[model samples]
Target: MIYQSFSSIANAGEETCLNCSTHVVWIAVSIDGGISFTDYQVYIKPDVTVGYGHQFVNVSVDQAGSVYLVYNDNHNMFYSYSTTFGQSWNGPFRINSSPSNTAIFPWSSAGPAGTLDVVWYGSSYYDGVNPPDSYPMTASWQVYFAQNLAATTPNSKWSQTTASGIVHYGGVCESGVTCTGNRDLLDDFGVAASPTTGFATIIYTSDQYVNSANEPAQPFGSGGGCTQSSTNSVECSHTDIAVQTGGTSLLSATTKHHFQITKTDFEQISNNPSLTIQVTNIGNEAINALTAQISGLPLNLPWTPALSLQPGQITTATTGALPATLLLAVGTIYTVTITANLSDGTTETQTVSAIYTLGAGIGL
Candidate 1:
C-alpha cells in the first residue's frame, strides 16, 4: 500500500497568522508496508492576501519506485514527479492545457515502464461563457486526459487529450451565498492503468436522469421529466459514475499538428554570417509539407524548401550565407518572424528576436 498527504486552510483558526493567512500543499509516502515515510512539499506560497485552495492531491506509484502527485488549486490541475520516493520532486506543471478554463478533481495512475496518465474535469462556466442562468444544470464539465511517456523524468512532456464528450454535468455549486451546498462534488474520480497493455480507464461521477420507477433515462433531456423547469433546464442531482477506456492503440483519426522552433543559431553578420533554425512536429500526424519564412531581417530571407515530417520529427533550415553588405552591429537586437504553412491546411507563425552577438546565439 502507498500513502500521500496534502495541505489545507480549513483547520486554520480565526487569528490571522502565517498558517491561517496562507495555504500550501504537501505529499508523503510510505513504501515499506506503511512503516515509515518521507514528506515532500508540493506547493507553497508566502503571500496570504490572495486566497488559494490547495486540494485534491492524488498520488500514484509505478513499479520502478517513481511517484507522481496530481493536485488542483481549485482552478487548475498541476502535477509533479518524484524519482527518489517522496524525498524530492520535479514539476508542479499545469496539467490542463487550457489556462482559461477551470480544471479540478485530478486523478492519476501509472502503467508499465513508468507511463503515467492523469485526468480532470474541465469546466467552461468559469470562463464566463456559460452562465448558470443561461444554461443552468447543463453539461459544462468535460473530462480531459494528459499522458506522460517518460513518467520518471522531470523533462517529460505531457500530451493532452479529451476523453469524454461534454455530457457529464452537475457537481457544480449554485451561485451566490448558497454556492457551498455542492462542496463535496460527488466524492471524487478515479483512474487505473494496465501494467502490461498501458491502457487506462477513468471513472468519474456525473448527473443522470432516472424515471420515477428508478430506471435509467436517456441523456440530454430525453426520457423522463427530470429537467429543471427554468429556461436553463438541468437534470436534478442524480450523480452516477461512468467509465471510459483509452490507450495508444485507440488514437483519434483526425489529423493534428503542432509546430515549434526547437533550436536557433544566430551570430553577428561579420562572424558566423548565417542563421540556422530547427522546426519540430509535436503532434500525432505526419506533416505532408512544411514551408518556413523569416521576416524582420535586413535581407529578404527566402522560404525554406518544402519538407515532410513524421510525428516527433525535427528538421533544420539555414540561411546559406549572410551577405557582407548587411552590416549588423554588435549588441543590436533584430526581430525574426517565422511562418510555417503546413499541407494540413493549417498555418503557424512564431515571432522571435535575437541580439547580434559575437558568438552563437539562440532564437525561439
Candidate 2:
C-alpha cells in the first residue's frame, strides 16, 4: 500500500511471509524526500487458511501527519493508526461490531481535518439490517462504512453506516470438487477524499444483473418447466463498479504541503551545456517557497527565492549558459544533481548523467 502525506510518502505491507503461520503488517515512512524509508510493525495475527481471499492492506495519511492502516484477518476487518509517522501504532480494533459476519476488502481515506473513513463489503443484507449477526458463506453482501472523528486517539470507536441497494452475488468454495462458477471479489476497492471539501467518494465492485434470457424446455423426467441446461444457463452477472458518497457536512479548512519536480531537461545552449528543472505543487494546498540547488558543476547556483506555486502549476528553473572553457568534449559523461528545498523543511532531489557529443565534424 502506497500513501501520500503532506511532507512524505508512506507504504504498508506484510513483513513476514503470507504463508507463514504468523503474519505481520509493516508501515514504512520516507521523510527525506522519498529517497529512503524507515519501517515499523503495526500489527501481527495468525494467517488465514490457504486459498482464502487475498489479504488486502491499505494506508492513508492525514493533514496532521497521522498514518492509518486497515486490513482483513480471520474473515473480519481491523484497523490501526500511527501518530508519530509510523514509529508506533495504537490498535488492532475490530471495525465491524458483528462477530458472526465476515468483512473484507477494506478501503480507507483521510479527510483534510484528520477524519478517517473506511468502507468494506460484509455478509449483511442489502436493505436496512441492524446488527448483522449472521454468517452464511453463500449469502448476499452489502457495502458498509465507518467514520473515525479523531483518528489519532487511542481506542476510538468508529461510527458505522451501511450503503443500501448494492449486493454481492458471489461466494468462496473450500474444495475444488464443490467449486461453482462463483468468484471472489479479488484484491481491493477505491476511496478518495477531497482536502478542500472533506467529501469522500467510495467505489466498489458488485455482481449485479447483466442480462435476461428466455427459459429452455425441460425433459419429461425433469420436474420443472424450464431447465438450467448449459445452453440456457444465464451466467448473466457483471462485476459492476458502483460509487457512493458519505453523508456528511463539509469540515473546516486545513493546510497541506506537497512539492515535487515533475520534469527535467538537458541541452546545449550556444555550444555550452545547460539544464532546466520544472517543479510543481501536486498537493491540495499551496506552497509559499521553494529553492533549487545544482551540483556536479563548477558554477555556483543561486537558490530560488520565495515562490508561491499553486496546485497543478509548474515552475521552471534553468542553469545559465556555461562559460566557453566549460564546453564539453565528445564521448565524455557529465553528472549533475538537483535538489529542491521547500519552505516546510522538506527536500526533494534528482540526479542525471549525460554523455556529451558534438556535431559529426568533432572527434573524441
Candidate 3:
C-alpha cells in the first residue's frame, strides 16, 4: 500500500484534490500476496463546528481494518475515527490534552488482536484555558483496549493517557541539577511497538513529568530565580522515546563507498584493449578502502577511466564513495574492482570496465 501528502489524485503519487485545493488526502491498495489488489481512496475533512477543527497526519488501520487519525487544528490537538473501510465516516473526536494548543505528531498502531494506541506531544492542560496541567507533555490514546482480542472495528471503549514525559537534568546546574528541554523534538515515521496475544505495548517520547535531579521535591536553587510553580522558563528539557524491538540489523551498503572518473579524445594512449575490472577484499570484516590496480602498464599515467558500480542494500542516504583515480595502459584496458568486508562477517566484490582505442598514444 502507498500513502502520501494528499497530492496523489490521479495516483502514481501525482494527483491532487480540486476542492479546497487541499493536499491532505490518502489512497490505498491492498495486495493479496503476488496475485491481485483491492484499491480505494478516502478523504477526511475536519468539521469546524464540533471537533477541535484541523487537519491530521499519520493514520493507522488495525488487522480488522479500523482507521484512527490525529492532527492539530489551530495549535490544538484533535482526533477522529473511521470505519466501514474508510467508506462514509464519523465526526472528529476531541483528544484535547494540550493547554493553549499543539501541533499533533500524528502516529498510531494497533495490537495484533488488541486495541489501537495513538500518541502525540502537546500541553497536558485538559482545562480549556491558559494554566495547563503539565504544559504540553507527551500523551497517549488507546481505544477499546482489553486484555483479550478485539471483536470488531471501532471498539466502543477506548482509553486516553497523558504524562509529563521524562526529564534530563544536566550534570552541571547552578544549584546541583542537570537540565535540558524540547517539544516537537522529533520528525519521522519510525517508532518502537509490539503486540502479542491480544496485548499490545508501545514506547513513545514525552517530557511531562517535572522532576529535579537532587530529589523530587528539591528544585534547582530551590526555585531561586523562578518559583517552584513556573519551571517551564527555568529548566531545559527534551524527550525521545526509544522502543527496542526483538532485534535489528544495519544495511550492507552503508559500510562501502563509490567514486567515478571520465576520459575523452586526446586522452587515450592507444586502442589495443577494452578493459573490465572487479575488486575483491580477500579477508576483512569491511571494505575500508577503494583504489585501482593497473599492473600491465607502460608509465604511471592515470587511467581517468569511467567505472560502473552497484550497491548491495537499501539506505537512508543517497551518497556513496567513488574512485578518485585510475591509470591504465591502452588496449591493455583496465578492470576497476571493489572489495569490501563489513562488521557482520560478510564481504563482496564488484567490477567495472572501459574501452581504449588501438595505436592511439594519448595524442595532444
Best by lDDT: 1
TM-scores, one per candidate: 0.52, 0.50, 0.36
| Candidate that beats the other on lDDT, 2 or 3, i.e. the better one | 2
What TM-score does prediction 1 earn? 0.52
User: Clashes in model 2: which pairs?
Assistant: none
- State candidate 2's TM-score: 0.50
What's the CA RMSD of model 3 in angstroms?
18.2
Deviation from truth (RMSD, Å), model 2: 12.6
Candidate 2 runs further than 4 Å off: 1-22, 32-35, 46-53, 125-137, 170-184, 210-246, 249-364
- The number of residue pairs in model 1 that clash at the backbone is 0
What are the lDDT scores of the predictions, listed in order?
A: 0.55, 0.53, 0.33
> Candidate 3, residues 194-304: lDDT per residue as tens digits?
422222333333222345562233233334433345443333222333432322111111124332121111123243233322232222233433333333222122222
Rank list by TM-score: 1, 2, 3
Candidate 1 ranges with C-alpha deviation above 4 Å: 9-22, 35-38, 49-55, 127-139, 167-179, 183-185, 208-215, 218-364
Clashes of 3: 61
Q: Output the lDDT of residue 311, model 1.
A: 67
The local lDDT score (0 to 100) that residue 43 gets in candidate 2 is 71
